[model samples]
Target: MAFKFFDKLSQDFAELLNDKKEYNVVIEVDKEENMKSFTTHSVVLRYRLPYFDKELENATTNENHIKTIIKPNISAQIFEIILKYIYGGIVNIEDTDTKTIYELMVNADELELKELSVKLENYLIQSKASWLKTHFSFVYHSIFDSDKFKDLKKFYNDIIVKYPNLIFESEDFTSLQETALISILERDDLNVEEIKIWDYVIKWGIAQNPTLPADSKEWTKGNFKALKITLQQCLPLIRYFHIPGEVIWKKMKPYKKIFEEQLWDDMTQYFISPNEPITSLILPARIISNPELPSRVNEPFSTIIKNEHVAELSSWIDRKSTTYSLSNIPYEFKLILRGSRDGFHPKTFWNMCNGHVGTIVVAKVAGNDEIVGGYNPLSWDNSTSTSTRMCAKDSFIFSLKNGNIKNSILSRVKENDNALRYFDSNEQNVYGPLFGNCEFMMRSNVSDFTQDKQCQCKYMESPIFQIFYNYEKPIRKTIELFSIVDYEVFKVI
Candidate 1:
């Protein structure tokens, strides 16, 4: 067996990156205002990066025989990391922030550094998953623009498949790229109703052409043709044969001009006669999964609360004097966001529970059996720039009865105008669900609720704080802030 000195060789190559004496390539990166230039070796760049090889070929040399390449779109910080990886085969991202690392991965992919880009992509998915989910829209849209990150696409699509509403109901759903929408529609387990999917597709197509008439009945032939062309890529992906005949007649009949004459005829015939053969291709029905709930098999519905707690909470929601029975609870608590499963970051709460309405947020107090929570009948909005108070007469905060708690306390909103507080986009990183006058609020200065004792439940019984009592009573006996063991946000369906 032969011994190798690759370690020494790598170190030497890394040192060469700092030597400006013999470098023949001058690379300029970032925009004109903050532009930076780096010196590199042509031989190393040619072998390490395929993109650089072609770029170098077309580049003309100066009198000093140094080739210059400019990349204004790439930030100087990201290119510096890439340059180091190219020369030394080392990427020291230990101190780099997640956003910077993501930018590095994108730049590496653009530079055709497959190994570096793939490594960064996997690292982001495995280690920085919470951040990815927190910035879901940006990450999802950016990845679909290029086909290089297949793993990231799959990682996000897995989440989208289970919770189709995350993407389908988002504010930017209309702005979604055609390729991205097609990829989602092509999934066999999309977990949305066929008619709903049809509606969303039509909605997306209409959004693309704002000039189209608002009423489908008022559409001219040209308007229909314009819509048909806009949805050409997405139309075929829909499983026409699986949609109910009534739904098809109600929804699909309006857009009949979009479909090919033969395919539409075949669909009509297939609906009339189930056994009749048709020339058009028939896609299998999408596997509609169970309603949105915790997918963990053999796991309890919640770690903090149980069925009894759910019944009590249900009673509170319905304004009933007595708790409902376990078998006859009026609503189902569909798990939307769990701190343990999703993340403890305040931003994670805003990201996952943005548009959800009628949500129950329960948090397990650290080192105690006290389960403090609040019910918000209004939807959580993360799109606003300023903090907004939601008006709700039914919203309330409560302390559920558990091991040490002998009696449960429920406090309904005293001030309907200030029932709940929705933090602005900037403040979302520090604050989560806030109920009346900081009565029941989750806050984390370190961006994690579990790591800090900033979560507060102010005692409203004190005379000095009487004016700030937005709820009927304080959920906690003490006014001091505390940390939480875990938290969960469930949509009351």
Candidate 2:
């Protein structure tokens, strides 16, 4: 009932605003050499519009006690819309073009109709995002030209940050004001190389001079001086030390006169002797460009393991460490198999673990609930011809305890040492004769450099060391020795 009453009252007020009458105040609108005038109720003008209220409050009374307000800049079309909104409590901007709406935004801003101005800005952003990107030059010039449209300024600034290359490489980059260019240069995470940034700066500076030669070979000292003058404010913003030494000595040598004597000498001396302190006390923060999160789009590997050991093993391979996330990892892990779920025999497991490169193995110890995994970058083969497929230096094993990751075992790929190589296992030729330079060994009575036999999965080839349930070191036996908690297999693509 209360809502209905307010609704009726609103309609009546709107009807009252629409009613035309002989009003007391005259608002003259001049546009395109045409003079137009609107008569408005003085009461409504003072009550509805703050701009008019301030104008009338400070205005001196005429002989006939009439107020005449002149707006020479506003067009008749825009004023008509504003007048309707001022009188009828409705802003009907439908079917209006972007330019007219832009004009209305300006007019609304001038009239202090903040709500209507916000509405127009939102409409432009939603409806004309593409057009705005295309005509960034016109849009940037118009918005920054006036201090009224703050929302518009922010909208453009955000889009510029997301796709900075669009503006940085555009022809209008040279026309960008110093403040605008500084805005782009200030962000440390602006995804661009230092060399590309230097090139753009030089281009923008060169564009500032009309008399400058197009070919850099024909550049004169006067042209360089002119460019330096144009880029004097911009040069300080660039991290000159971060650029390559070759580029500094070769590309920037021509512009040496531009830099202050002290700064140039400091830069040159710093390159010569990096250990010595430089003039600038600060260094640029390096860009944090870690890989983005992986997409589960192309048939992801997900498991609901019943045992805690298998659960944690599955968690680590999919880049879900309790302490670390996989956002920094560049590979997408796809489910290849699970040892307990697949019910693979020892011979089947060996055959399956042979030739698949980039495989990760997560084994959970039943006694201590310690999770261990190995990353194999090279595939394993059964050939005893001293082949390159024997044991890889890139293969590494890791341990996860209490959700923290630690590197447990790594292959000793050292020069003048053939210790961590695969040869015929004294026990069996199919899966034995595993000798490696593995760290944190249980026991290696085989030799000083060569360790005990390591297990190899024949199909998915990687050196594997067995983990005992109640003990760290297992006796020289196959998978038939102890009770296993669980194990998971993953392929990193």
Candidate 3:
């Protein structure tokens, strides 16, 4: 057998990537403020990627015989990774963040780098499965925009079929792509009721045409035609004969103008005489099953803290002298956001937790089991342009006892006017929940708290050397900055 020396060959080409002497292609990436250019050889790109092959054919060369390709959408970081892979036939994501890796996969697919895209897609599904679920909504909507990533589509579709509400009840359900909607409807195992599916389809169709009257009863024939045309692809996927006759009359009658005369007559006749044959085709009823709830739904409320911690936190919220027993906690801890599930970005915090009142923000310190958190009695506002301090007499900051820490500490607000600090909209991208004058705060310049160690629990003293504590005591024994393993924001209902 012949020997293989791909490692050496790869190393040689990788070194070539750094050589600026003979490059003939320049690629400009990212928007204006962050735009960056890279020099490359066209021969490497022409043979390595089909997308570049076509792009290079159409691209005109300058007098220096160097061709330029402008890609404002792709980030410079992602392109750098792609460029290395193109020349070296190697990819190293060991140090890259999961979000960056995901973006690289998307960009690779766009550039027709099927091998790279498929490899990254499989890696994400196998290694970063937790991250994929945490950013489920974004991932689901993004994959449907194109026909690539079949395995990812199947992976998410399996979850959607079991928990139909994840997609159907989402806030942006109406904005779902037509292909995605049809894929769900085409599923024989979709567990939702037929009537509800019909309603959602009608809702989706109506949302596409804003000019249509609010009331279907006030609709003109033209409006009906407009809606029918919008829903033409979706209409056929609905199981008409499967829905109850009463529901048909109640829901389907108003939109009768959309159906052909023969189909409508056939449906009506089928309902009147069950034994009669009809010209319209009848699709099989969906295979509905009351499957056991997925582990995600049945999992404990918070992955970072247990029920004992919840009881303790609840007792503190109501200012109870004694910790409430597990069975008799007064308030329910309703989780609105989880750093591991939603995202670790500070902006994700403002987007999801905005306007939420009576909230508790808990975070597990990295490299240890210690949990520190703050309570905010007022709503979190992301609309403000200037920094604003919320006033709450009952708000407090605390560190819960864990394996690494023996005793829990509670620090009620000593300064009522500075109980909580809400950052301006521009600063929200870097700063999350804040309490007092940097007494206990979550701040990340990199936009991801887990990726940075900027979050702190310090006790600051005034310039005059007098104690400038905003709260009664420090939550952590040592005043130091730390990263987090995970964080959760719950509404104390």
Please give the range of 10 consecutive residues that has the lowest summed lDDT in model 3.
459-468
Give lDDT tens digits, candidate 1, residues 82-112: 8888778788985687789998888888777
Global Cα RMSD, each model? 13.2, 23.4, 14.3
> Model 3: runs farther than 4 Å from truth?
1-22, 28-36, 42-77, 84-103, 110-115, 123-148, 261-279, 299-493
* 1-493: candidate 2 lDDT, tens digit per residue: 3345755655665665545565567778876478788767778887778788777766556787767888888888898888777766677654566678877887898789988888888877755453455456656776666776787788777655545555664436677777677767777876667767878888878777877877877887777778888988888877878777788998887778777888788878878887898777445953745333333222234331223333343344333435222212223454565656664333333355556555665555444444544555455344444423243444444454433323232222322132233433331232221323332121123321112233321121123523211122322222321223555556654
Off by over 4 Å in 2: 2-21, 30-35, 58-65, 135-157, 211-213, 216-220, 249-251, 265-273, 280-282, 285-493
TM-score of 1: 0.54
Using TM-score as the measure, name the better of candidate 1 and candidate 2. Answer: 1
Question: What's model 2's lDDT at 287?
Answer: 71
- CA-RMSD of model 2: 23.4
TM-score of 3: 0.53
For every model shown, what is its TM-score relative to the native structure? 0.54, 0.50, 0.53
- Best candidate per TM-score, number? 1
Clashing pairs in 1: none
Model 3 clash pairs? none
State the local distance difference test value for candidate 2: 0.56
**How does candidate 3 score on lDDT?**
0.83
For 1-493, candidate 3 gives per-residue lDDT tens digits of 9999999999999999888999998889999999999988898888887678777877779999999989999999899999889989889885687789999999998898989999999988765553564455567779877788999888787667766764665546787778778888898899989998999899989999999999888999999999999999988888888888888998899899999898889889888897899988899999989876522234587898787888788778756688766544445567899999999999999999988767899999999889999998777889888888877787899999999688899999988888888888889989999998777899999999999899998854443532577888788766678999999998765
